[model samples]
Target: MPSAWLSTHLRASRPRVLAALNRAFGDIDVAEDAFQEASLKALKTWQQDDIPKDPAAWLIVAGRNAGIDAFRKKRRETLTAPEDLEPVHDGVHPEEELTLSLDRSVYRDDVLRLLFTCCHPVLRRDQQIALALKIVAGLSVDEIARAFLVQPKTMEQRITRAKKRLQAARLRYEDPDGAERSARFSVVANAIYLVFNEGYSASQGSELIRETLCEEAIRLARLLVRLFPGEPELRGLLALCLIQHSRRRARLSATGQAITLEQQDRLQWDRTLIAEGIILLEAALRKATPGPLQIEAAIAATHTRAARYDETDWAELDRLYRALEIIRPSPVVSLNRAVVIAKLKGPEEALGQLEQLAAPLERYASYHATTAALLTELKQFSKARKAYEAAIQHAGTEVERQHICSKLDALRSRVPGL
Candidate 1:
């Protein structure tokens, strides 16, 4: 089999297989190790023999066996009794047992259980998100580290600490009750959005986006929305992802440079996703219990509703951002509102608004980039050049750095020495 095909299959099967393994073994570390073992085995076996009819099922069975073996080894080393080990099945084959337990609903619940466990309230928010990205989304330690702007070692420690915390908490593998699910819903939603953001603008690498991460985040959001259909914020979260993902095709240039939203080809945007997002947003609005995610989705909806870049209702966007500021104020939100101010009130006013955010967002590349753009519009070439340089210095990814460089070059063309 082709390596790409194998890689894709393994990634797709990871959540289901790992979730099942976690349910069976009742240990995240064991489940993860077992899944890795199973994957390694598949690499050798599938190449020598024909691929299994159900790869995930094969993985689940293999992982269960691996977990049992690991336990047996530990039991022997510790002089533990046989009864303390995994139960031995008589007569029934491993595959048969796995098949009996392979109910789709059970797997779905298992996945949710794994997600909630990773996002347990006992862990800090960063720890929860890092753990979820690693365990549930299957992101690499390095990938999670890049997203968090930390070293791989630091991220690994964070994840380790989170797992230890979870182990201490002894969270149940059973599906959460209504109250429990609702309580954990916000953290889960935030983690999913962070996952989406990481994919939407990957922190590092040649590519500007990681479609796999985006797809995984969307899949998780879809599952969450299904589990909580009455929750407006959940609907809004899914809507936000769909609407943003709709522009994936048009977000990059032929040379792999990031494309500005205004410069993107509207025709390339996915109309189906946009339509669904709008419908979801409308439904959420009817509930009238607006949250940050709902407001963010509304902002995105406002952008998509415009027929062209010029047709965008800047005034409406300004109003929405002001509302967002009142509801969930952050430097990032303020930065976005500044862009709308630039469109409606000119660069001078936008720059004034951004000045207040400098202390809070000095290390944020987008803030510098936005400031540079506003400065350029005002024909303050020297200041714009400085801002662009600052943006490039703070850029998290090679693609982002290159994008800022391209803008800087454009600015230089307008001014001889800039």
Candidate 2:
């Protein structure tokens, strides 16, 4: 009688319950412990019966009650009976129980407030990301470590240190205001972007895409927008995620090979998501102060609007990349611009632009892949072969490596003596 999607439901509801516990207990350590206790109860109860109608509310109320019992035991200098710690389930209505347990307003901003805390400036960026994934996204220690290409113990330590630092800082659970809120907003936004990118391309996994993680990132971005409705960048971030994720169906071929954008079947893309992304981007643009996310969303919009690859407005894309470089100069951004140049001008021009990037992008697999493509187009067979070999060495996933190897084989067949 257990629901097949019990894990998914638990993950989705964790943030709400954990956030509420943190607010009620006013301590991250106690909150995490109480939520775990409540989750065990749900695991036992939901298997025989159906999952609660309001899972988040159920977990929140149960966790709050459990945390209160722990406090009572601690203050009394004795352990409370295990039965006394269990959530009340003596035929009480779930909603009625939740309503009597805690005020609804306690959780209205719970997730957002938790996000701000995890991304506080005091923690290192890596620590912030790990904490957010564990606390907010409900990813396991091993899952988070796999995403970071680190050992599970390392990630565990990082999270422990981050929590300890937060506890030591004695930061309260309250909504930030004015400039502090703006700073925290940017930090939280960047962390969410990192989450989406890892899911989008999977930097260190056999699977080219992790749809669940991508969906989680999008969900978090939407939550961020609701919390900070006036922030244009949050809107842009959500729009960018939706537009990019619309092509998930076309990102890999039927045989699990990586597919290039030009070769992907356009019909496979999600039109509804594309339309919503475009609307959001247009609204963000009307604000007149374009952040990096807004500019990136505009560039993605340009691609989604084109009916066919040939119809793509490369000239305009070139302009946007130029603007992006001026705003945020990154080797990765420059590499993207090289693609536009290849389309607008020619391989020779694109190759020239790419050469200067070699040093900065020495270890980047895409740098080698792009170079190989441009070299192949110019009939520089020997150099192209080397670049393809390099790309294979640097490739993150098996699919990417296989794709590059296939290209190398095709080149060998075309030029008999190579």
Candidate 3:
């Protein structure tokens, strides 16, 4: 009966265990098999007695034992590994290894190390994403398919190809050095952030936001920042996640409608995270390279410092976005900066900025909604009504589509011409 919880624990532990096993034996098949075997042990044992206090640690110890045991039972008893790989059974004792049970950090290192390897430039971007989800995030091939809007078989094939590519490249379970180090680190940062984004806000799921994704992202950001204290960009990324995450509580209304950031309750924001974000951003800015994260954190800091939504410093934000554009110009960032423009000048000025920039976001309802809002501000009711109608066409969620329809109806109410 107690075995019920075992499924949940194993699912969560799979990615971490895979990471640890691959690091220990340098073989994905062995690592995966060991984790599966360890899950069996947990199911058989936990029901008889109390579950281990630190279940992840217990599972890790079990996995190591399982891996070495299988390695010893290999096809050829006299087989020898290369100089880079020592036999798992060579002078290794499980009792001594289990003694380090309290040190759960050791097992966690594999997940982090695997993350670094998967994000290596040698791997294609899709490969990096699939590998990270397959390994670090513990997403099944089916789940990854749903996330990417692809078929399950397609995702399975993608993962298979990525794994083969990773092995062919002989990617090590260690962070690279010098030029490779800096580049590889950025990929790792991006992968972790993407995982968190998926969890924080589900792209394909019915829910507006997924708390698990958000928590995982924040956790990874914290881990990376701790591991690479000297790297300012890492710290900047952590700060950005922290600040954005602080507003999670107020993102959805009581009826589960997605609330705009300005409408979100400022008091509900996580003050601790905001303060930490500010501290991290300040530290990260010391390095001369003004990166995208630094700019994002700067913007988040401004929001965190504001007494109320109306009190947000638009001029400072405009200048910061300008700096951000120089570093990494993005349509999304430009759209965000337009909100400040609407506040400082007028909707017409903001509309001008939006028009000049090509928004590849036309297919997205949010893009249409934003245009409609600006048009409404300009008193161009007919145009606003038309944009809102278009917005409803692309709206992904029912709640968003309802809001767009309401906007369209409001315009129609004022003018029969609409």
Candidate 4:
């Protein structure tokens, strides 16, 4: 198999196979080691022979056997190894038998179990997201660090601490009961969204978006929705991801510059994804649960419903943001609401609202950028230039900096000496 194809397959299979190994062995370290060993073996084996019919099952079996071997080595036990053990049925290969025993529902449950384990209440929110991205999403430590806008060493320590905390907590490896699952669901969903947001607008990189992380997040969201079909929040979460992701194609220019939503070409948007997201949003709204995800999805749906930029229902968006603020009040939500308010009201009123947020969103790049935009609209060129400078100073990525700089350059053109 080609290296690219093989890499993609391995990444896609990683969560399921690792979850299975973790469940079987009851050790995160052992499961990770086993998966690594299996991947190494695959690199050599698949190149020589044809790829396995079910690569995930093959890895699970191989990894399980590898884990047993490692355990035997650690204990120096004379126990019969996995390969030495007799098959459950006559003439049945061990891998074949194990693969047959495992089914789709088992894999889905394993993935969910792993997600919940990573998002255990014992760990902090940042740790939950970082660990899930590492263990379940197969993101490397550096990748996680980049997403968090922290040093790799710092991220490494955080992840190590999280695992140590999990070990100390003695979390159960079995599937969570209904109460436990429900309790942990919110954190799990938040972690997944954090992952998606990191990809949707990467924290720091040459590229504006990270397709792999986005795809992995969508896949995890789909898994969650399937596992809890009646959870309106999960449906809303999936809808939000799909709707936002539909614009990925138009989010960046051919030269890789960041493109604001209003400036993006709607013709490039994926209508299929938009339709699916709308359907999910409508279904979830019918449930009338009214959660944060549903409100955010409603916001995105409202944006997509507009055939043109000027046609967007700014009033409805303002209402949704207010509803979101009541449910999940945060500086970020307030900042976004101010932007919608700028559209429905005026720049002065929006600027007043933004000023109230300055204290809380001092270090946020988008806050500065939005302020600069409002200032520019009001012909406050000097203030806009200063705000744009602040935005550039706090910008996460090269592309983001470039985009803000472009605005600054345009402002300078308007006020030559200023």
Question: Evaluated with lDDT, which candidate comes out highest?
Answer: 4
**Which residue pairs in model 4 clash with each other?**
none
Residues 1-418 of candidate 2: C-alpha lDDT, one tens digit per residue: 2555776778778877788777767777788888898788777777545677777777777786778778877766665545644655534336466656655445646766788788877898888878888888777898888777788999999999999998888887555677776676778888888778877873355443266568878988987777666788889999999999999889887777878889889899999999989988888888887788988999989998788989999999999999999988999999999999999999999999999999999988899989998999999999999999999999877777888899999999998888
What would the per-residue lDDT of candidate 4 be over residues 336-395, giving only the tens digit for each residue?
999999998899999999999999999989999999999999998889989999999999
As a whole number from 0 to 100, the lDDT of residue 305 in candidate 3 is 82
User: Which is superior by TM-score, 3 or 4?
Assistant: 4
**Per-model C-alpha RMSD:** 4.7, 4.4, 4.5, 3.9
Model 2: how far residue 342 lies from native, Å: 1.8
Better of 2 and 3 by lDDT: 2
Where model 1 places Cα greater than 4 Å from the true spot, the runs are 1-25, 33-110, 121-130, 138-162, 168-180, 206-209
Reference-based TM-score of each model: 0.76, 0.82, 0.79, 0.83
Cα lDDT, model 4, residue 343: 92
Q: Write the per-residue lDDT of candidate 3 for residues 155-264, one digit (tens) a residue.
A: 88887787787788886544445677677667788876676666555235534325655666676677677766777878888998889889887877776666767788
Give lDDT for model 4.
0.85
Give stretches of model 2 more than 4 Å off.
Answer: 1-13, 39-61, 77-109, 121-127, 142-158, 165-175, 202-209
**Superposition error at 339 for model 2 (Å):** 1.2
